[model samples]
Target: MDMSIVLQAGVATGTALLFATLGELLAERSGIMNLGVEGMMLLGAMAAYWVSAHYGVPWMGVIIGMLAAGLISQIHAFITINLRADQVVSGLSLNFLAAGVSVVLGEGLNSIKGVAILPSFTIPLLSQIPWIGKIFFTNQGILVYIGYLVFPLVWYFINRTRQGLHLRAVGEFPAAADSLGINVYRMRYLYVFIGGLFAGLAGAAISLSISPGWFSEKTTSGEGWIAVGLVIFAQWNPIRAAFGAYIFGALRRLVLDIQGPMMILGLANPFYYNPYFGFFLQMLPYAFTIIVLVLGSREAIKKRIGTPAALGIPYIRGERGM
Candidate 1:
């Protein structure tokens, strides 16, 4: 029960959630509900592995991975935003599409094995601090620290910038925003693309950073869904989402890392020692996701601060009524 190990592992896990959550947050803020995040992440993961294996540069894989996922997400954008298809169905379809395509591409790419992991860089001077250094700096990747920067910048963009104000206005009231000379459709497309970029990056973070290898296996393990839930749980706040990611990250890590150690020492909980508990343990993160979502719903309603008013409703532009 070393706290530092938990902190380090938890933050590593949180980094993935943070990226996916922020991506979804951007899309939702602009009135688009992109459920294809899981698909996008998977595609990115596969692509990251292939490119990293071929080119021998994790950074190139990251760039290509984002492009691949972002491109896939744009199809959802076109279907939902342009053709006005049902957003949910389109996103779900995108997920299946990615799964199928990944299976196909993965067949050939699976031969390219054991890609190198992105290097982890420890910050100088800061790494010398006793507890803070170990928990925050030691063995942490650059992307984890990048999440710290992204959180505040996103907070400012969403809450303080004029364009973000317009984006919010578009999500909450497209008709009014249209009346005020804002292009509703454009805003939705913009945010959706931004969301896709982050989702792709999330997937790349998985293959390139965490596990450091490629497999046809479902690498994300329903993280995209948890990310979706996290948006609701955090009431769409980047800062809050960041906090929730780490806490839940710790919970998932506890399930994976602690169970075997505890059982070997005969100090395990009954639940942990159960023969059938392995699958259930995997559900810990999602279960906590559901709980947080339910808990947040009350606060969201109480403060009148949850959800955009016009989210998921496509704007027909100059048509009467919603």
Candidate 2:
């Protein structure tokens, strides 16, 4: 298998993961831990596919998908922010709710065919470069290029800007921020909504660009969970998150590709000969995700580093309980 093809596909796949991970990172930075990413993603995918199939407009699908996911995300925000419910429980419940809704609503979508899909194009001068061009610029989805710009912009926003500082301050010291006139509840709600928007966009990327159809819950196939794990792996840094997303994407593609081809290092490909072996190969990505999650969990607990201090804690005005 050509490694360039693997990487190019990885970049496209990774763009979806990048959006989801960035969304989660932003919410967590504001002291809101949302575990409903999976549900939001599934709903986004279903909504995007449904609109595209019906309207024959991919962009319209993208918009509706995002708005639908963003709207649903408010449920979690209200529960955690207003009712002071457990973030983990609220997120998990939201996940199940969104998944069931998508499956029910997306019932007949699988039979739909020839729906317009998001376009893919190659860059002019940049596509002529050597290895980098092949992996990033040539014949890639427009969203992939957008991913390139978004990571740096997000990094700057989080680390260098005043608003970014306020976000971090709210996460680290909500009471302090409240004393300084920053509306703690407002900021939390806003970022949680933004996170939902990003998650919705991630779902759109998959249905409209990467995979190009709705497969119900299988449309996301647990990529939302993987994105959550990636937040910990990225250490709450956008640049690191982008890198990890692409690497995981590449690994996922590689696992599938390795199952094909006639030879591996001049030897017969066992996976090709025994197709059932592909199941084990397919499991590699999720297995790696689990390993990364475990390692990241240890690091966060051992050092208490990079984790927002007030995360998963509700902030009541005029109190320092969190």
Q: For each candidate, what TM-score against the reference?
A: 0.93, 0.97
The prediction achieving the highest lDDT against the true structure is 2
Q: In model 2, what is the error at residue 181, expressed in angstroms? A: 0.8
lDDT for model 2, please.
0.92
Off by over 4 Å in 1: 108-111, 263-276
TM-score (C-alpha) between model 2 and the true structure: 0.97
lDDT of each: 0.84, 0.92
lDDT of 2 by residue, 1-322 (tens): 8989999999999999999999999999999999999999999999999999999999999889888888888999999999999999999999999889999999999899899999899999998899999999999998889999999999999999999999999999999999899999999998999899899999999999998888887889999999999998988989989999999999888988888798989999999899999999889889999898889778878877888989999999877465
Clashes of each: 0, 0
lDDT of 1 by residue, 1-322 (tens): 6767977888888888889999999999888999998888888888888888888888888888888888888898899988998989999999899867876786766566667768888888888899979877888887888887998999999999999899889988898999999988888888988898898888888888976665665688888889999999988889998898888777878777655544544456655567467778877787888889889999998998979877788889889854
- Report the poorest 10 consecutive residues by lDDT, candidate 1: 258-267
Q: Give the lDDT of residue 155 in candidate 2.
A: 96
